[model samples]
Target: MQGKLYAIGTGPGASDLITVRAARLLDKLDVLYAPAGRKGGRSLALSIVQEYLGEAVQIKERHFPMTADATQKQQAWDAVAADIEQDVKQGKQVGFITLGDSMLFSTWVFLLERLSDKIDIDVIPGITSFSAIASQAQFPLCMEKQSLAVMSCTADADALRAALNSHECVVLMKVYGRFTQIRQLLEELDLLDHAILMANASMGSEICYPDLRLIESGEDLPYFSTILVNRTWALN
Candidate 1:
């Protein structure tokens, strides 16, 4: 009998937010592989799902570098995938947890690409940070006849501008690094008044900025920050 691999999304950051299916899978995992962003950093995803993990579950916490160097990232991904593949081949049920949805802007995507052909992979979806943010902020992402665009701060200026102009609402993910620039652009588009910024959504550190103008010019938000702009609604 061959072991199966599961890619579970642990949800935005809350433990209770985990799906029932994901919870059940967590309880049955023989080995849990958690990825940390830095060499010595703790796995935040593991923290979110630790309560559901079985007592006998083997925890394998590994570091995946967050950098622009493709060679380093490729090497780390290859090594990690190899380890997981080997474990699955040995008939040990393995699981990997990711934050938000596994398919969206996640490291799980790379793992899936490498291991899909080698093993039976099951992807268990979970709540996304933006979805939790909208709930916490009492935000309605869209309404009838209103289109929504989801983007990232890393996007080029033209694309960002186009999204803002074309969509009734725009969600900007990973906006911390380019907060100032994005904020300025929103101001230029006269959409700043319609926007809100949220950091660490659903987590204990969660903070919602109903008015983006309230943030100082040099202020830096957490890496988990996001911004939502709705031309149809003027945020406080």
Candidate 2:
């Protein structure tokens, strides 16, 4: 009798944004695995869902190093997968929580790839940060037949430029430290006025800048910061 593993999305930083399905599962799951940046760093996913969890629910934090080194990342994933495998083998239903949707720019991707063959896996989707941001900013991501492209802010300038030119709307995720560079490129392409910056979307302290020119260079932003660029759309 092998237990199951669920990859649950806890949604963007809000406690109320968690899906009904994810909330029910979080209440019933035997163990919850949360990803942390360092050994003892706080888990954003866990923080989002903590209010719904009971006292008896077991929570486990696994370190996922924020690095470009493939070997270090692989090692961390392998170790976490092994732990999850043991729990499943013992007939304990384990839940892994991720911020935003499980399939989109999530750490659950690596875990699922490593454990899919070895166990029964279920994925529960949740609201994305950008969607929440758009709502908060009163902006439309796309309308009619307009196309949208979602990419990382860390992507090379060429790729970012191409996305800006090709897509009617482009979403740049993880825009914390690279906001300046991204804004510069948008200016070069004459799309700065059409861009908006959102940080900590849906959470307390949420900030939105419809005008990117107001953001000074070299300013530090939260990890959840994002930028939405629309070539032919405006919030007005």
Candidate 3:
């Protein structure tokens, strides 16, 4: 019997946000794996579904280095992939859960690239934080023929400024530590009034602020935060 590897999307935070299909698949998982940070070896996704998983099911936390060092990051991902591969090769079904849509900017991307060729991979799509944020903020992304750009703000300030200047419905993912700089750019472009910042979207820990300046003056937002800019001028 060939085991399966499900790339499950937990959809932000709320357990209900998980897709019906994803939830069903999760219920059947023999083993659950999630990315763990350096300090606390707890998986956010695992915690969300902890109540649902059976006591007999095995849970694995693959510690992923939360740093900018490229070498360390690759090593960590590779190690996780190897661990997942070991389980799947033994004909044991496993679930690799992520915060948002697995195919999106989620860490599941790394797992997919590493394990797809070795096993049967099924990606269960779930509501992305950006989509949830937009909905919560009552901001429709685009109408007709309007494009949306999804990119990470983990790059330099210049790169982020370029993206903000170029894209209209830009969903800046991973704005964890760069909120200050991003807020400054938004204010300079007079977008502070219209922009919406949704932190920890879909999760039980969620916060939204309409004023970019207000968010700028506040504390650092979680990594799950996304910046939604409805460039009304771009629609013109």
The estimated TM-scores of all candidates read 0.96, 0.95, 0.89
| Candidate lDDT (C-alpha), each | 0.91, 0.87, 0.79
Put down candidate 2 lDDT per residue, 65-121, tens digits, no spaces.
888999998999999999999999999989999989999988789988899999999
Model 2, position 63, has a per-residue lDDT of 79
Q: Which model scores highest in TM-score?
A: 1
TM-score of structure candidate 2: 0.95
Location of the lowest summed lDDT over 10 successive residues in candidate 2: 35-44
lDDT of 1: 0.91
Off by over 4 Å in 2: 37-41
Q: Give a tens-digit lDDT track for model 3, residues 80-159.
A: 89988999889988998887787877778877888878888888898888888987878878678776777788777777
Q: What lDDT does candidate 1 reach at residue 7?
A: 97
Rank ordering of all candidates by TM-score, starting from the highest: 1, 2, 3
Candidate number of the best lDDT: 1
lDDT of 3 at 83: 88
Write the number of the candidate with greater lDDT, choosing between 1 and 2. Answer: 1
What would the per-residue lDDT of candidate 1 be over residues 135-214, giving only the tens digit for each residue?
89888789988899999889899999999999999999989779889999999999988899999998889888898888
